[model samples]
Target: MATIDLTEATFPETVGAEGTVLVDFWASWCGPCRAFAPTFSAVSENHPDITFAKVDTEAEQGLAGAAGIQSIPTLMVFRDGILVFSQPGALPAATLEDLVSQVQALDMDDIRRQIAESEADAEVDAGS
Candidate 1:
């Protein structure tokens, strides 16, 4: 399947709906982004169960900014509407595949809960 282009208007519904989705934040002008595009696309095809979407920083500035995207080819993986893995860089195909496998191995529910608890702890610490 062709990769989906995610913009601010459709970002939430697409990434936050359900299941595992990997969102690639990229820009057309970026060489690394161009190079990584096909690899990412191939991964999407290889893993039909996962939804792979790309967001063009140039076109989806708001959405990119909201995601705190500071570099081209930032990859974020979400499961069951909660973010699980996030990394910034161009990863080789094998590495990317391994990452997907690692994510699959994780208990995302506990991961998300831990993240929330950590954030709350930080907030409480800051307030004191």
Candidate 2:
């Protein structure tokens, strides 16, 4: 699927859906962001099942700020409505493909269990 432009309005619904969603936070002025755009788009074409979305940080400052985006070309991967990966930098195509494989291979049930355990631990610590 082609990369879709994500605004503050569409971001939540698009990334919170059932499947995998890869969001590229970028600005047109950044050199790395420009270099990564083609690679991001090319990878999206190969992964039709995943939603590839881009948020222009310059235009969507509020959304980017809310996401804690401190750098251009931040890539975030969401699977099953949970954020599985987030990093700042432009990744090579091969690395991006490898990341896709890793995310696809994740057992979400185990992940959810781990999250629950962590939250419970946090609650216990808070009470202590």
Cα lDDT computed for each candidate against the true fold: 0.89, 0.97
lDDT of 2: 0.97
* Stretches > 4 Å off in candidate 2: none
TM-scores, one per candidate: 0.88, 0.98
Q: Name the weakest run of 10 consecutive residues (lDDT summed) in model 1.
A: 103-112
**lDDT score of residue 84 within candidate 1:** 80
Tell me the lDDT of candidate 1.
0.89
Largest TM-score belongs to which candidate? Answer: 2
Tens-place lDDT digits, model 2, residues 45-115 = 99999999999999999999999999989999999999999999999999999999999999999999999
| Candidate 1, superposed: residue stretches over 4 Å from native | 119-128
